[model samples]
Target: MARDRARLGGRRAAGLFAAGTAVALALATGGSLSQAGAATQSDAAAQTAVQAPKATHSQIQLLAINDFHGNLEPATGSGGKINDIPAGGAAYLATHLKELRAAAKAKGQDSVTVAAGDLIGASPLLSAAFHDEPTVEALSGMGLEAASVGNHEFDEGWHELLRMQTGGCLPDGDGQNNQNSCPDPKHPFEGAKYKYLSANVFFTNTQKTLFAPYTIKTFKDGKKVAFIGMTLENTPNIVTKSGVEGLTFKNEVATANALVPELKKKGVKSIVVLLHEGGFPADPKAYNSCPGISGPIVDINAGLDPEIDAIISGHTHQAYNCSLPDKAGKPRLVTSASSFGRLVTEVRLSIDNATGDVDRTNTLAQNQIVTQDVVQDPKTAKLIAKYKALVAPIEGKVIGHISTPSVVRTNDDSLESPLGNLIADAQLADPSVVSAGKAPVAAFMNPGGIRADLASNAGAVTFGQAFTVQPFNNFLVSMDMTGAQIKALLEQQFSGVNGPEAAKYKVLQVAGITYTWNPAAAAGSKVVAGSIKIGGQPLVDGTSYRIVTNNFLSDGGDGFPAFTTATNKVFGGLDIDAFANYLSAHDPYTPVATDRITLGS
Candidate 1:
């Protein structure tokens, strides 16, 4: 027989209370009556005589957020559906959490708020400029219980992450004393309050783990809930190789499953898996009434154990709420709140007395947008204001001007827009970058790094607008690659399950190079014959060429392993500073598409 799926609507709420009442009544009446009489009672009388079961415990509510990336202040959108709502800010998120906690309390429920990694790293100038310590402090104020480690968490290396976890104390870029935790310091990071979870990440040399594998929290109702945190297990492949050289990321499913018996032995029947990986459907742009039905969530949900009552996911930065059946055909709640603190996911679990397990029959999950429509939390607002003041000089300085509006949308294929091209060109032109013997003969920028669009009003481009375009302080790195290696790098850009469609991972924003590719051409032969060139010269297959890109790409982000094959790599300082200097040196600039890339007409 097909097991009944849990209904996730208002009816489910009614069913929960009704079921509790029915069970209570059955237990009450059966205890009061003689065994023979109780068995002989008419069905109608038995129903009436039975009393509702008084809930021995309250419901468990877990509130989760992910991929905040240290966006302390709210950001204005450049384009896309997200622009429809006001961008997320830490203050607004705090207000939303307060309201949710109050609402849950009104119903006699216990609630806890947590996160699924990328909470820091790839941050804006407000936080990144200060080594992301401000973001750590802000999250601490927001009461983040714990977060699964994401790839960006190791952007500056594991030791840096540890500093952010404890009070921030690290050497300056010059290897001098710049400990924010120093007494009477100019910039102190003495206020961090959250814990990081690392179930699978471990050190290679000492075999010592970075953080605790899992954390157990006991609720007011005496129910102990165990949360196991793990990333995609491919952390090393996506992050800079040096950042994770001493760590090993184990399998997510296997890691979480192994913890089950340990948690059970500790008498914790309710388990929640907070994995930092996510799912994406074949078409991310398609609007579906039921959003979570399609992506990686579907496969991960199906593979999870029945004993696991819920899974909180992240990394895709998409919002979804859905329930999938586990091995026992019991509904297991799986959810992911949108990125940048734009939304929060709520999971409600009801425990069954008979089995000492979560009654999957009554699990409820939903995601709510964090909007400015709600009142702001004063403390969170103050922290944002403080950081804004600290970074004001840098954030407000005029950088350059744009004559047209530039847009950045991931689902679209136009990665090399006028604005992205200009930024890449600026990095390649920096004197510090050019001084290197193999100055960037070509450059590539990841579309994902371009956060916003530049709005042109036939006038000056303000510093705020420029920073928004390329916020992360990624350094420019130059490397030497042969023509064949470049072709291999471009092949990673296709998107789909079978062919080039499965290669969406390879899209590049090019500078100083123009090329045409044919989709109809063979996979290995996608670059049309004699189409690629550097500086108007056809790229020689045997000759080496200089390439410029952010450290992330040089180290192979988005599955482009071919980049790591480059020789004579040189780190040319901060890419953002390079861009700023380039803009200052060449103000009043007008950028146009040079037709660097063209899909065969």
Candidate 2:
């Protein structure tokens, strides 16, 4: 670290040069990646670094973060802390990356910065208001080379995702979701300086992909390392339909395995997969421990070719380090950095000069907390100040207060969560829908839709804070469903039913209803008989009741197909609007009881 500081100024100058080149081109073409320019500034920076003297140690350092969710400023409340330590924010993240890069450089070790995905979408008001342009620019300014395209990347639809990758200003000027895009007409919204690789996401009926499937980086010594990036295969099911209309996602392992021979043909053996899917750590509090860790990544890793050297994952947003066995039964590194920029996974690779392959025995990984202990990166801080100033008036508005310190989605349990209950209740009480035709007697909110928690701001929350919790901008939807159909929706939350519960059991957060379910029972029969009640009255199979939910659910997102069978559909205002109104109206809202969801028979 000490040795690299002397030359930090030089690298900064080189980075500035690259940024200038990109900005000039963006301005020339109104923020589009011109046909003549095949690479981004990040790629230029990487290529420039390889011109340095060859490293004595054959080690390559990989610094990774995932699920950043556009947090340009330090988070507050429960989401801001990791194990009781103040963490996250783009400035601190940049500081950490520079420090790690500098330290590695001092050791003559080549290093690259990367992310798993969810770098944008479901962001705070500051970033989302600008269509996440600030996030793309911030990561680019700090030097992110590549990342997998997570489900959130498709939240706005195919064209938007492409625009995010290529670069362009949103045509509509301001007041988008109560925020402006391209705030300064003088400076257009340039896209990512980093590459977004999607090996599994492909164009329907075509061999091409939305973006390049993989990328290989060559170092000073002529040693090459290949990175294949991909999101989970079930991305279409989780994201809105329009976003993935003309695309198809292939199996992760198969897609990666098929690419191995091509990479080998190019003499690249040091392979790494940037996967946007992860597992839950048995000990969630301990960032480094991975004992009994289990999830979709485990199976995905096992199916990968043994030639693949390492795996960096995200999506579940929990951190852990483990040496999971590959196809050959030899242990290899698999890691994840918890979400919201709280942790960063550092993976060190020692390659064999003889075969240009990574030696599994020498591979080591660790998750570093992005503590507020370091000096915040000046460039990132300055950039954040720009957005913060513009977002001040709206973001600072006081919404309401809650008695509890937090109403968070941190605990994704089967029964219920305080945050989920609050959202469902808010949707059920939305005046926009209530005053239209018939009022919904019950409201359901998908746990996955709640991004952040309602942090208590000294018992007075701000709109900025509330915006982070539900940023999707999905409108409220009310429809009529038979009691029997409602029962089917409840059953779908478990496996062997019409859902993805085999991997993740999604218990719907409810309002104005109560029911019990047995986890041990067969999936189709998980819902306890005679337990469901609406308005303190026993549910009858033939009875009809109105239910309110988000538009995504009404479209049958997240495996609840029964939502699609409903009738008498009525749309209301945005979910965020309803939440803000509910908070303001309730003033000192107390968290609802968890009694609505019973654990067992």
Candidate 3:
């Protein structure tokens, strides 16, 4: 993953992951990688690799992906499928991209591969173990020209995000961190090859943008295309607070509109926005339909200047292609490829040579699956192989087994999922949380915190699979909250107090408690009165009880502000460690519905 074997986001600067392991073979095979500093080539060099159009007015192809999440290997289970077809793998993705570009080239079309955001973070062991360098290298190899910054990009904090943008070694390199910067003394981690554009993100102290606000790509026909990329304005509410400490995210519409005049001055008429926020659509398949589509994007798109040609979006991980109206009431092209590298949105635009503007009437967009049927890109496969071999010992160790069919994230009618219950119980039973006479009787886990279903190889769960389930390295925290505060916490799950996630449910997976909620009730009064119970007893408003949950939740992540008022907070170790150790202790664990909550009509 390093141009010389870089680590993923530089989890730590310590420990050598077998020096030169990624570089020797990768360089020999001509894998895509660039040292963060001087070794990184110029933009002109990268653009020169593409075939330019010989004819005037040739259509430009925009191949885009979003929320890749560093699934370098072919994802498995439902996560790997789109419309029931197996899809997603960096190798397969590279192959499909090459084929698509080739087809475009044959038609005299110039193509550029780009992404909306979330190319990394919440990754599998293959990319994460090396600090996501593999992912940056893979995407750069596949010709990713530009991308927006997603909330996950700041998971390790803005400083680390800066490290990813520019090349550097992690401060903790070589000896300490769980993930080494892959400790390559020679080739040092190379930053991303593509430009990370953030029109909305700014450092509070400097008031300057974190990265370039926009980048222009010129074509052979003397036409220039301007790309303005940005994450959603509400990034702070979803991600851990400390990660975005000195940064401020401006409104999506305002930021893009403000740049319109600046871009027009540069004679850049064709503008495309790569946004990290998206919406849910009526069609589940989301290949071509956009029936009844609604979300923040609809309104944001409607407010965007008509000068912006198209919108490529990610996050929410839903696939859809829609032509919604822009500010001038003209239909505009907007698309999203589902997460985990499963789909690529191919947008073809007819450029007007005279005006240097996009021909809206001729705009075409489609979501192509990164199907496994195609031959995998060999270079990328070797890159995957290089990292896989390095982390084999740790990733392959069987931590436990699934006694039941599978512990899944799928929620029942009550919104309680098997895997969620398991995670909550794991947190509650964690030795650190429960040790030394700690009396935490309840533990809660946010559904968003559980990234994936617990996967097992032939029923044997490994450390790699465990990492996938809880990829975020958040710590466990036990805090004291009186029953009144706990009840207030439950009430905050609905609208009127939980901020703008009004239509969605933010239910917490629980252990050591049971409660009921009435959906038909008013927003702030949804939780049924007197239904809350802790340790099989009725709620006691005056009594204080210790509850355990991830630090994200305790810090009021996902809008549960009641946690912020909690007292006597105690920090446990990494959440992933607790999950893996729990699996070991509860080996051959059968998953059963805990039936912790009930829903009232």
Name the top TM-score candidate.
3
How far off is residue 295 in model 1, in Å? 3.1
Residue-pair clashes per candidate, as listed? 19, 0, 18
- Candidate 3: where are CA atoms >4 Å away? 1-56, 171-178, 183-186, 434-437, 496-503
Q: Per-residue lDDT of 1-601 in model 2, one digit per residue for the tens?
A: 0000000001110111121223233334544322212332334554344423234337788899999988888777667888887889899889989988998899878898888988887788888877788999999999999999998888777788788888877655476557566887888877888999999999999999999999999986898999999999988778776568889999999999999999999989889999999998777775654556778888998999999988899999887765666677666677888888887787777677677788665555567888887888999999999988888888888989888887776543355888898899899999777645679999999888887778867888988778878888777888899999999989887854344435568888899999988877887898999999999998999999989998778877888888889988877788888999999999899986677888776
> Candidate 1 lDDT, tens digit per residue, 1-601?
1111100000001011111222223333543212211232323344333222237534677789988887777755522124365647888888888887888888878888888888876666666656677677777877778888887788777766787777655445421211122222665667357678998888875545688888999876467888888888878866666678778888787778888999999998999888888876343322111232455566676777777888888888766554445666554566677678877776666666555567654555556667677777898888777766656665566767554454333333433576677777887786665543547788998877777765444556655566666665567778899998987777666532224444244557788888887766767667677888899999888889888888878878767778889988777766666766776777667676546787772
The segments of candidate 2 whose C-alpha lies over 4 angstroms from its true place after superposition are 1-57, 401-414, 434-436, 496-504, 588-595
Decoy 3 TM-score against native: 0.87
Give residue 28's error in model 3 in angstroms: 55
Residue 391: error of model 2 in Å?
A: 1.1
Error of 3 at 237 (Å): 1.1
Clashes of 1: 19
Between candidates 1 and 2, name the one with more favorable TM-score: 2
TM-score pick, better of 1 and 3:
3
- lDDT (CA) per prediction: 0.67, 0.79, 0.78
Give candidates' CA RMSD values in order.
Answer: 10.0, 12.1, 11.8
Candidate 1 RMSD to the real structure: 10.0
